[model samples]
Target: MHTTTKTSPIETKDLVQKTVFPILFSISFAHLLNDLIQAIIPSVYPILKENYHLSFSEIGLITFAFQLTASLFQPFVGYYTDKYPQPFSQIYGMLFSLAGIIALSFADNFYMILISVMLIGTGSSIFHPESARVSYLASGGKRGLAQSIFQVGGNFGTALGPLLVALIVVPNSQKYILWFIIAAIIGLGIISKIAFWYRDHLVLRTNQKKEIVAYHDLSKGKVNWAIAILLIVIFSKFFYSACLSTYYTFYVIDKFHLTIKQAQFHMFIYLIAYAAGTILGGPLGDKIGRKYVIWFSVFGATPFALLLPYVSLFWTDVLMVVIGIIISSAFPAILVYAQELLPKKLGMVSGLFYGFAFGMGALGSAFLGKLADVTSIQYVYQVCSFLPIIGAICYFLPNLKKK
Candidate 1:
């Protein structure tokens, strides 16, 4: 006698043609948890500095260690995964992060801290490319909105990190960082479920007819040129962003003499605006063309970013919101544009952009830390303010919407 087997309801539909909200949100929430855990490293910087009596240079080195490990491994991971997709791989990433978190909580020396963050960074390197591929697969052709949903969760998590650090780890002992392991546990459970869905989805796809592939009309050389320009734009955006994200609290503390908690609140406000901007970026890109959003998101922030350093505390806070909104929108649009440019290489494209962004932010943090050591925090802002001006080059990119 033959046995009958049951299939999931999702398998009945052409998943490529239908937006999978459940999976999109599941992966997005997983992204949120993943980034939240990662954000702990930056959020606890003040604490780390105070505890260890670390210089700005040392602080920057810590960030460098973490981001270097995170950035360097991603492209290789994406390339390998493209050939052999691993549905449960994110679980291993989470385990690495968990180990890092435990190590960080108990870390005694500077080198130990470096090693711990490097482990966490490794997990991040593993997480982003795969999660991004899952987002693309679940997009149902609404790539922008899907990526936005996936991205916004991470932005929101990043916003929460500083606030949580202020409330939890800052006022208390460094050992309190162990509290974050709960986030890891929850993330592991979520990614495990996502892995099952991912496995089933792969099986379904193998059994189904081939899906239509998308193409861009630009020549390979033009495509390569466009990619190079996008990387330049990424450098412009993320490097400046690193200055704010890594040092804004110190800037405010030095400039305005605010306490750590107060400065953290301010950081939370700016990051909240950053997260809100991510929501509008993707859907707007779908409607008005990603090139326009990319151009506007990057260059449009120039005036505001330029004015930020010279303003009063009140105006500085206001400009943070404005700059956050405008600048944060560029990434979603940029990633989706690159993915469309090389539709067949989603994993590679995502890994490259994400890795490059992390690398730029790391270099910015490290270099600016040394700069701040030599000059001042305010000087770092003045130098970084010019970065967004590079966005003017976006005018040269071909309009994908025209085809």
Candidate 2:
């Protein structure tokens, strides 16, 4: 009995470490590469606008196509993979992005640019749902921290995108985006290896309910209602994010008369703060409870965001960093809370939230773009400043974490 007990504990420990970190970090690195490629789109928008003689509405349409493609396919992909897991599918998704990047490099007109981004968007749709499920499977009950680790990678890549644009893509022609093809290739290789790990550890999938199942007794109606509220929080978060990602550079340029590179750098400041927040939100949720993190991340940003449209150039930069950090923290908490709400449907829940976030971002960018055209980019910021007020929805979310 003594020998058996000792062996079992040792075996379990070995299994836990092997299934969790190695796979999580590998998948996280893949996310980094994937998002870097995605970030390139917004980073190069100034050039796209100039090359295409695009209207603000047209620039918004580019995001519309990309986000629609990214959003619509995610839930379907998540649902299918939940039934029949596809470990290598991510590599294929990356290849599609590679094709899109190549086409985008030479895209002479608006339609071609749309096609290129749609393909990249398809890659994101395929990548996120599956990767998120894998993260959950490998989490070993540290869902929040694992998710944050996974997110930080993508956030890091996102932070890099604008910096790359400022240093490389801004001075060069459209063809410079082709440099990211190398990142896609590296991602494909990493995800291929991750497929092997996922296949090897498919046995671990059975334990997914261990953490959340105790609290899962809530009615399906409650789950749906909670999900609806969570969706609103996501809408507020990503829509505000879209205003920054899609239009902040233009806003800076118009208001401060900054050069394109200078505006891109300011955008990078916002994104890096966002990346930092992404890294912290997950782990903080794990420790202090997802609910508190949700409330803090969402409502906490309100004052900062509200101040942004009214601040001076120096304060604008400072307030955006505060807004980015506070606001972006909400996502990790929100996603983990939703996952626990419907523990059985991790893939579906993740896909829906991720998809909804993408959809909101697209819709906001397009809607705000038209608004900017009608009013002004500065007015759009002022309008979006109030989005965090919707975080009151968090007050309604049930705390799934048992005391």
Question: Who wins the TM-score comparison?
Answer: 1
CA RMSD of each candidate after superposition: 1.9, 3.6
> Candidate 2: lDDT over CA atoms?
0.87
Name the regions of candidate 1 deviating beyond 4 angstroms: 1-13
| Model 1 C-alpha lDDT per residue in residues 1-403, reported as the tens digit of each score | 9997865545545655678999999998988898999989988888888888999999899998999988998988888888899899999999999999999999988999999999999999999999999988888888889999999999988998899999998888889999999999999999999999888777776666665667878899999999999999999999999999999999999999998889999999999999999999999999889999999999999999999989999999999999999999989999999999998888889899999999998998999999999999999999889899999999998888733
Consecutive 10-residue window with the lowest summed lDDT within model 1? 7-16
TM-score of each: 0.97, 0.94
Residue 386 lDDT, candidate 1, scale 0-100: 88
What would the TM-score be for candidate 2 when compared with the true structure?
A: 0.94
Model 2 scores worst on lDDT over the 10 consecutive residues at 205-214
lDDT of candidate 2 over 1-403, digit per residue (tens): 4553333544544564443788889988999999999998888888899877899999999999999999999999988888888888898889888998999999999999999999999999999988998888788778898899888889888888889878988898889888888999999889989898778666443433333243567898988898888888888889988998999899999999999999999989988999899988998898888988998898788988888888789999899888888887888888889888977777788889889999999999899989999999999999999999998778887777765
> Cα miss at 3, model 1 (Å)?
5.8
